[model samples]
Target chain A: MSTGSAPPILETKALTRSFSGFTAVNSVDLTIGEGTVHALVGPNGAGKTTLFNLLTGFLTPSSGTIHFQGRDITGMDPERIVPLGLARSFQITSLFEQMSLLEHLELALASGTGLTRKFWKSVKVLGRFHDRGMQHLEEVGLADRANQAAGSLSYGQKRALELALALALEPKLLLLDEPTAGMGLEDVDRTIELIQRLRHGRTVVFVDHNMHVVGSLADEVTVLQSGQILAQGTYDAVRADERVITAYLGESHA
Target chain B: MSEHLVGTSHLETAATAAPERRERAWARPLYLLLALLLACALPWFIYPPIALDILCWGLFAISVDLLLGYTGLLSFGHAAFWGSSAYITGIVAIETGMPFPVAILLGALAAMVIAVPTGWLAVRSTGIYFAMVTLAFAQMLYFVANRASGLTGGENGLQGIPRPFFGMELIETEAFYFYYAALPLIILGCFIAWRTVHSPFGRVLLAIRDNPARARALGFDVEGYKIVVFVISAGIAGVAGGVFSSGHGFASLNDLMWTTSGKAVLITVLGGIGTLWGAMVGSGILVTLEDYLTTLGFEGIGIVTGTMFIVIVLLFRRGIWGSVQQAWHWALGKARLRWG
Candidate 1:
């Protein structure tokens, strides 16, 4: 993918992170093509989340480089990285529990316009973003709950809201960390459908334990084991690989 | 179509929610007006100096609330701003003979300047560490004030802070007159704070307070918001301090002590940590009680206030104003159920 004529939207070279003596992500070289949904699949301790953290600038890599749209973004702060068209949703849902869903979307919308820093102006000025915020909420099937506090949302709904928030950023490269983790079967289907709709015009990198979600949504799949890439190719190619079956798929499939 | 039915139902729910939201909104301005009237009449009921004390302390508590309640920053060194402003206001008044308002402005600006470095260092830490860092800074300032006896009046305290007239012969700087004179500025400060919390900036602060990591991911400079709020809070506290010192013609070491910071925090918790109006309520109760006890020759006022604090915490976990607001909403819900 990196060797293709069209430049990759996101690329990582020798990406590595360690916590004291324990290395979480070791020498990961990843390349994600534009407008394609990429899945990072691994077992529980396979360093998928740590790799996401490094890519999104949440955690600084011990030794590595991250490039977004050909710009070096290694060890940059999350706040700085986001403005460059990279956004991520956490594995565990994170939100302002007391704020209404619409308010959350409005804040995300206002963030892009540089209006979130205006302490002197009345919040009424954000009324301009109201319709757009509702549109984003509607996209995630959350428009009906727009007025409710985020804390009142169910597990599935909160994950949907998190997706809505990341989408509000209008990021060029969207990262989803275990987007279907802990979701019900019904919710999992809805989320997969939601991601399917969202996959147009942007690059997506997601970590998931659900092979079904991986098969349906992922155009390319990278399987990891013990902080190293075990297989990288199309979903079917990676699924058929012997190392992946023995290291990851064996336990779940068996 | 089914879509039409869903849309109509959504509108129906929205319509039902609107009136309750409006009713709650309308209650705020009305309560504010009533409070204003009560504040205007307070001097007539009690000693004017004590009334003035209530106003200053009320503003102080509100400043603390801006950090503790809104930004989720617990500052234990707010006395640095309050005391520094008091000392600066006194010094400016005595040396430059500037109008008290100008002096107060400079004092507030000084507080903001101090906050830049203090907040920059302190905001990098969270929770108890943030509080400890702030307390350490305040203690440093306190010792500096003590050691620099030549400027800060050392242990003697800065005295004879004049309440300069506002370019009119009829205006007086007496406690009663000054209370009315200062009330407008205090109201303006309160208005600034109110506008701040309701502004986009305030929403970001709330977002940061709720989940800093998520906020950062959303492209918000969470540390920047914290520092900005910290400085703003200090400036407001500075205004209160300047007014307090000028009102009494005294800027004492007590104003800068860690105890003073504790007192402001205690009052905020008493009133309701997050409610702006609660600061005033807490201040009124605390200042009035202190005055009443002093008049009765009671030396151990802390004992009574501490016990009250414990009881309030146990019974009203959200504080007095918070509990009252909650009950009001609960009653409103019940009334709606019955009437509608």
Candidate 2:
């Protein structure tokens, strides 16, 4: 998808974050090209999620510069970053449990349309966006359950709904953290398909432990171990890297 | 095949979906009209002064509901708005000789001014902490009102606050139709409160209440929204306070008492939190009970009221009016599932 001459759309320069004296994310420079899906892979506690949080502005970096399309966005609030064409789905499902699936979609649609502050207007008047919300739900195959409570959805359905929410923003860059966690084989396949279909013309950075998913879907892969990048290349290249084999796969095996 | 967008709107389809649903919609407005009619007739049935007191308390309870029922913030300092406005309105009316509406506006404005900073600081902590913070602020106001004898008339309070008659000091004549005079303002305040709860802003407040972190993640300025709603709620309380001071002919230290805030909370909870009209119902019941009990020389009436509140809360989780609506929906849904 990249012409190879253009600069990376998102870049982190020696980003580091520490909590109380424990460095969750150490100095790591990551780059993601335009219109490509990049996978962040590591064993547990490798700081993949912390890296995602830093990029998404959920957590401020202890020290580092994060740039999106070459503009600095190191400490921007998640709300501010979202409108800048960057959206994210959480590692754990972040949802309004009491709200219906349609209501969830409506809120995302409302946020995208900048209608959240419209206090005088009834949300029923937002009927114009109802079809659009349904369409997004359809994308995730949750259309039939639109009226069902979000909390009532099965674990896999919740994950699908979470993706649908991020997609509702129609963002240029989507950061997905463990998008397939807790999903069954069929649900994971559907989720992967949905992500694949939606990845066109968008820059995606995702973290997953599933090597098969990373191997098949990622245009590039960055492997991390102990809060540092162990390898970065095409999936096959990174998978074949000797240090990766020793530090990551070898460790997992042992 | 392309998905059909369900061409008709939700309300448009309601007629075909269920006759009961259609009737229920119509019944809501009809019920409201009847309630309004009853409210209009209340002065004839009860002493006008007691009815007027109920209307004032209704407004105050609605203000509390705007935060507690809708936004999910339990404020223990609501009297800070109510009492501050009572004092300000009385003082302004007595000293400045301002028109009734002007005095009310000034009082409401003063409430908004206090709400902004206190709401700003209080919204930082939620639940019990928020309640404590608001209570602390209200206590501060009470102390100030107690000490400021020159301005607030201290323990004696601002007594004999003369109600204006078209900018004329005809306190004697003006007292005759005080309920009728205050009715329009109360109606206007209720209408505005009703409009606000049904507004898009109100929906966000509900979402924030349900899940603040999720609301924040969805790009809502939760703290900022809280402050705005707090100020609005305070302004509404101020309106109630203004009416009370003018109607009762005094602004006393009792207005600033923490128990006043507790009463507003109790009234709201009793009617049904989040039900805008329920506040009025709660206030009406509470005020009427107080009036009847006091007239019969019933002492320690708080015990009776407290026991009733516990029974109501335990039996009807949604409060009186809300429980009725919930039960109706449950029955309707059950019937539809079984027979329809």
Candidate 3:
């Protein structure tokens, strides 16, 4: 996070999203520094996922401005925002069941590069772009399973594919909502390694219930509680906050 | 180990191993040559009229499969686009001396125009709801075609459709040029479908169809991709319908019916929803079956097709092409195991 010495790459200003009478996400401002692994931690139903959804354009904010690289992107479609160097991965491994694992990466690579459609005689000629897809797959240690149907992959392998797809976006900022959810212990370690490696290219905002993951990776942490920011600062700083402990971790040496 | 080699590389693995990209480029046309053979040569061995019918429906299946297989939108209203184009082609060619190709182009354009609005509405709904909305809209078109006796000639259909061009006049029924002329267009149509399936955008369409949220989060315009596929597929289907009307010297409300739409769906399912070659196979089998049923004077081909659809859905979700591919992979795996 440049020791908090530079301007934020992504910032939320009074962002709020409401459905009918219920407000799932409330107006709460936060700044995520450039190249920082910003951890968003909260107990269940604490609006962590909702805030992720709003930020990534899955859900539009009802009020407030969202700035990415100093550009206002309050209510842009998730699809439109992807090319602007903002990409996300789902908590679940949302992938094509029928296609090869490599094909998934290829699609993501094509998308991230804005090569939406090419009416050429042979798509195989675009091997340069295809090579990048292979690189992404290799980064996740899935070069071997490149051709295997993604659906046939084990749960952990699918999670790797999900991460690979997000990375293929080549985004300036990445929002990962529960990236490690439902993964085995071994998978958690692999995914953590993948996230750590990704920090070289872009900032990552990841949510996880696992405090160990949060403490190990988060450059700074923001603790959410009941649709509001309970505490924010370094992992230790948020961990020591009385309000964070009382509201979320229940104060018993948590 | 064999599984790893054969795994997914069966489709385009050669491209990966090739040292020169230009050397690998020539391989693309071989697939087209084979498709041309199927469309052009096969009719010589079969009844010309029947072969022509298969070509028409094969084109239609390819069109529908482009959207359903590629984009993952199980559209039921493609018949609205197809049937409307037929009516336009039939009415125009008969009323004027416009060439058949020009009329067909008009039909395709009409379908694309309709597709944008319908696709816009359908894209908002996901999964089964999207399928239902498309079906409802198509049925609405079916009603309009059936009621518009003045233009479309209603249930009885418009007669005296002309097949202009093809070097002098040719009979719509026994025209040998149907095989020669229509065959090229049919091959070209299949080529478009083939290219789209293998292209970069085609890959993204499959990805979005598979996982919209993931595709979107990866920076893809999922909605835009779906709409684009829908419009393209609808336009292709319209051209197929135009070919059908001009070839038969008739256009009717029957073309716009729900049953007609279901026929294309049946072909897509039977062939393999996602596989391009499988679509032609599906179209061939379904068209042949319907023709046999007609000759037998069997009143309800629907009963048979409906049962087959249910059986395919339950027992073989991959359809014909998918199952064949699966079997081929299984065979390949077994062979490799034996070698080991």
DockQ of each: 0.51, 0.36, 0.43
The Cα local distance difference test for each model comes to 0.88, 0.84, 0.79
Order of all candidates by TM-score, from best down to worst?
1, 2, 3
**lDDT tens string, model 3, A181-208?**
8766666766786788788868899999
Models ranked on DockQ: 1, 3, 2
Worst window of 10 by summed lDDT in candidate 3 chain B? B1-10
lDDT at B5, model 1? 9
Q: In candidate 2, residue A17 scores what lDDT? A: 90
Of 2 and 3, the candidate ranking higher by lDDT: 2
Q: How do all models score by TM-score?
A: 0.94, 0.89, 0.88
Instruction: Tell me the tens digit of each residue's lDDT in model 3 across B293-320.
Output: 9899999988887888889888889998
State the lDDT of candidate 1 residue by residue for A193-215, as single tens digits. Answer: 88888888888999999999999
- Which 10 consecutive residues of model 2 chain B have the lowest summed lDDT? B1-10
- Top model by lDDT, which number? 1
- Candidate 1 chain B worst ten-residue window by lDDT: B1-10
The most accurate candidate by DockQ is 1
- Of 1 and 2, the candidate ahead on TM-score is 1
